[model samples]
Structures are given as C-alpha cells and as structure tokens.
Target: MSKTVGAEGWTVVHQARQKHYDDRYYGQFLGTRKDGRWIVGRMWSGRSMDDGFHDGGWDWSKRFAEPSSTDAADAALKSYVEMSHETFVWNRVFEQRVGEAIDAYWAGPEVPGAPRLSAGWCRTPDGLPGGSTVGLPFHEAKYRLLQYLRSTESTARADLSPRTFNLHDAVELIRQANGPFRFQHGYNAYWLADDAS
Candidate 1:
C-alpha cells in the first residue's frame, strides 16, 4: 500500500533514495496540477567534504524541466536525471526552493518554489552526444570518433567489406563501450579508422 502525499497543486510523483551522506537527495519529481510540466532534480550537498566541492555554503544543485507529460512519465521511471546545473550558489536559496517544491508536492493548494537555474553544462565525455546532434557536421563527427577511441579500449577498424553501418551497429558498439556516442557517415569510416590508428 503506497501512501499518497501532496501539497499546493503539485504532487510528488517519485522520490529516490539517499544512497550516501554527501548526497542531499536523489531523483525528485514534482508535477503541477493543471500543467503537464514537471520539475526534476538532484542535489549533491557534499556535506562529508569528500570531494572538496563546497561553494560558500552550498554544493552542486541540479534541476531540469520537462514540458510534456510523456517526458514527465518517462523521467519518473528513471533512477536519476541525466543533465545537471554545474554552478553553485553562496546561500541556500536554491535549496529552499527545492524544499518548498517538496513541501507543495507532498502537502496541496499553493504554488511550489521555482529556482532560477541557468543553462546547464554537459558533463559527459568529449566524443559522446551531450543531447542531440542531429545537424552535427561530418568533420566534428570524425573528431568525436577519434576522441572516443582514445578514451576507451575500443579501437576503430577499417571495414573493406563494403557494408553500411546502421543504427544497430552503433548501438551495439556503444553498449560494449558502456557509454553514449555519435556516428560518422559511411563514406568517412575508412578515413576515421586511419585517423584513429
């Protein structure tokens, strides 16, 4: 039997466990009443001072907004959200905002606190797709491939069999490497292998 909790117009859809003392909280989801927008975030308090990431009085706080209900639903299923705000503030205003959000999410008739988070940075590796690179240039794609090889054990191989690399191949390789990646065009694969070697 799951106990339901709410406050203001927002509902607490999902709450993740606090695995470590340094972690203030993990994957938190707050959904609005009428709007489909959801606030998803996490906070690394660094209370233990293990990583020396203390900024004035606060550590890293990350928040993300999902506009569509479908995205919100998908996010609720995940253990933690991917992208996060790399910046930190001196005061606990950001922390307070998240607390208010949690309160409204559990308690009913008021608006939750909204934090003004700037555009976040991608903490992912150099070669991987940070988000979407649909219109990424071929030269850039080639550079990423080389970077990926340099970082990982996987080496680029030149295939002279004349077979086209599809989405499945790319996915399999990424799975083996245990990371995200972007693919270069078919014609550039041979040259990419040469560069990697």
Candidate 2:
C-alpha cells in the first residue's frame, strides 16, 4: 500500500494523524469486497493486541464497516477529504508565511552595544557593514519559531540616550536588525497593511 494513497486492492483514503513512532497507523481505509460491497474501515492500527496482533515489531489493527451504499461511502470519504484540506491550509499558513517571517526576524544579529540606522540596513558612518549572522540551535523552521516565541522582547532603541555614539557600532546594529519582523507576514502583515490603508 502507498504511504499517502491507495494501491494493491486497498487505499489509505484519509489519515487522521501520521503514523506514530511505534509504527501504528491511524486513518480511514477503503477497499472493495468480492461481493461488490464498499468497505470503509475505521483504522486504529496497533491499538491493542486484541484489535490486531503484533507482527514484525509493528502494531497492526483495523475494524471495517460496510457502508449502506456506494453513495454513502463516497460521501463519507469526501467529507474526510474536505476536513483534511482545511487542516492543510492552516498548516501551510503557519509553516510557510509565518515561518518565513520569523526566520527573517531572527536572521538579524542582536549583539549588545551595537550601533544602528533609522530604517535601512545598519551601517557605520564610514560606510562599512556591521554585525554577525549567527545560526540558531535547531536547523528546523518550527524550532526556530518556538525559540522566537520564547525569547524575551527587548525595548532597546537606537535613539536611547546621550551615551557615546560610535559609528561602527551603529552600523553593526543596523545590520543585525535588517530583515522583516515576525509580524510582517501571514495574517498579521495582512491586517497591519489593511489598517494602514
């Protein structure tokens, strides 16, 4: 059987959740009986030994119910597909646009005692680039987003005080904060732009 779709006399029509580390499947299964009855099984593979026996170190279980009619089976499967589509949309929004924005936000360096510009990339009066781009701990986008959410927000501003003004430090600061902020994409960006209008 195909991991994503059906094949070889049966198909995994709709999956409620991905297979667990224990190698158990959770989803809807579709097949045709020799008598032409449509079998739409509620699959909860590896739930228990009674539901299914363990084989080759993998838990396997499924309980099928025949639909009253082909029309009913088709409708039920269609509903599952619709629900899956809705989840796909939200996942895309969170993982793509929101993820990209957050990465862009943290891509900037936030070193202490650095100088910064008013709008564009941070640059020194001598016209040299500033700051270092450090990599986050995890290589995944989701973990980066989590780090961003858990990080403490700093109110440090470029116009702070009459402290010593170093051009090189200012340039470094601007380079550190040169990317789009976390709220600059996804629905947050959209709403912000709408409000600006």
**By lDDT, who's the top model here?**
1
**lDDT minimum window of 10 residues, candidate 2:** 186-195
TM for every model, in the order presented, reads 0.24, 0.21
Query: What tens digits encode model 1's per-residue C-alpha lDDT throughout 61-119?
Result: 32234654434433532313332222222133444343333323322232233211111
lDDT tens digits by residue: candidate 2, 1-197: 21322233443322343344566534433333333233334443545323321221222322234433334333434443444343232243433333233233333334444322112122233433322223322222222332332221121222443252222233223223333222211111100011112
lDDT of candidate 1 at residue 62, scale 0 to 100: 28
Error of 1 at 12 (Å): 0.9
Model 2 clash number? 7
TM-score leader: 1
Model 1 spans > 4 angstroms off: 1-8, 21-27, 43-68, 71-80, 83-197
Steric clashes per prediction:
8, 7
